[model samples]
Target: MSQKHLTIIDHPLVQHKLTIMRQKDVSTAGFRRLLREISLLLAYEVTRELELTTTRIETPICEMDAPMLEGKKLALISILRAGNGLLDGILEMIPSARVGFVGLYRDPETLQPVQYYNKVPKELDARMTIVVDPMLATGNSLVAAIDLLKQAGAKNLRFLCLLAAPEGVERMRQAHPDVPIFTAALDERLDDHGYIVPGLGDAGDRMFGTK
Candidate 1:
């Protein structure tokens, strides 16, 4: 199905947090903390299509009907380690949302992503899946994740990330343009090393303090 691809780079608070996250000298603890904070901010854009239902309820003073979210739980799929950073923060607000993980790593030979692990909920067909990753550098991993989700019967899909490069966004646009993408900032370009230009460096490494 064709879907509108939306990018969230307009919010000031989002921009500020993203800027801090993108600095080269930021500490690992600080980098991870910022990712968590930015993910919450990005979650606002990702949940725009959530279904809402109306019900009768009573307030402390007034008795009135209110609108609340309906059933068919949401599935927030994280793309392994770095993506896990966002999961905790989003779960803080919507703790009941079902979680899924898709583990994909770049193959040493092809530099292509290889899926090594995937354990999604059994009722994926009835859920709205949002895939989370910190950066969209090559777009291969995100594209691969979306492809796998489609094969699993996930029709409604959205992508949430901290930052996206112009090249990666365009590549994703061509491959899966129907999927909406949410991120705090869109950098000018990707460097020759397959990293976002002026990107904070390997998100996983920086976030984990490994390098």
Candidate 2:
């Protein structure tokens, strides 16, 4: 996957909220609120290509064909903890979307993903699945999560995040070239510790007020 596979959502509102959220002094509650708000905007960008079909319906005055989402309900898979922040807003936008969770934590020494839990909706092969997480840093955990989802029969997939680093995007491109990535901003690069430089800090910590 090249830069063509990456979508940088340059929406003004999303950028504004993201800028505020990136500040060091932002409160946890404020950060959480901003994440939810920005996620709503990102949801619009991520689902823009959803298949649509017209259906016959009787209107107030006459019969007409109205456009509606086509095929199976969308699947929203959260890569646990931090991903939940993005999940909340997207769910609000698409309430009928099926939900799933894949829990993974990074090993401090290796900076690799360690899976602990996995629960995903069935019939993933039939639904358009969107994986949500706030950061695409090292991309190890995300790659592992998507690997599990694909093994379980998910065919269509997309990744949504607040921020992305070049390293993570490249990693995802190499591992899952078919999947498109949507993010609010593409930052400079990832630091030695696998953190996105100029990032707001650990999203899980910022959202939950943890160390």
Candidate 3:
């Protein structure tokens, strides 16, 4: 993966919150809270380059022109289950952004992603799409999700994740070089079972207390 296509958010606050989330003993409530807080920070970074325009507005004392977001509302596409965790927090910051979901599950034996559900807003070609998933271990799910989004007319797209593995990054780079990735931490690698090494285990299970 090219370094230019990936951004490692090494902010102290982000790292600190990620550390708490990675702990084995962290409670469901604590994990969910930290994920929300960290996602707000991530959302700020990902939306840094949003185009701005001036709009005339009246202040308490006088009328003035103020900067505001320009163009169509942004789209946030969550890669189902785990992605919902990140989606909620980012939505808190960008309540006006359009929301979408792609539901997929890994085939236990093949370790490949299988799409079961998908729903996105119309006119995707004009909006900046941000795809969110907690962990990018195998990259199959993300790559598949991107394929569907592109087929649906999404042109400008970005990927956001809490943690990523080297293999997953490489896979995504090969498949979708145009899409840049924003992540909190890039871990060592994927383990034998395709889980990210030193990662917060099973983000969905941890956040929802399923396991």
Give the clash count for each candidate.
0, 0, 0
Error of 1 at 71 (Å): 2.4
User: Predictions ranked by TM-score, top down?
Assistant: 2, 3, 1
Candidate 3 lDDT over residue span 110-211, tens digit each: 889999999998989999999999999999999999999999999999999999999999999999999999999999999889999999999999989999
- Among all candidates shown, the one with the greatest TM-score: 2
> Residue 40's C-alpha lDDT in candidate 2?
95
Q: Encode model 1's per-residue lDDT on 49-104: one tens digit a residue.
A: 79999999889999897989887889999998788988888998788889999999
Q: Decide which is better by TM-score, 1 or 2.
A: 2
Q: Which candidate, 1 or 3, would have the higher lDDT against the true structure?
A: 3
Model 3, TM vs. native: 0.97
The list of candidate 1 runs beyond 4 A from truth reads: 1-3
Estimate TM-scores for all models. Answer: 0.93, 0.98, 0.97
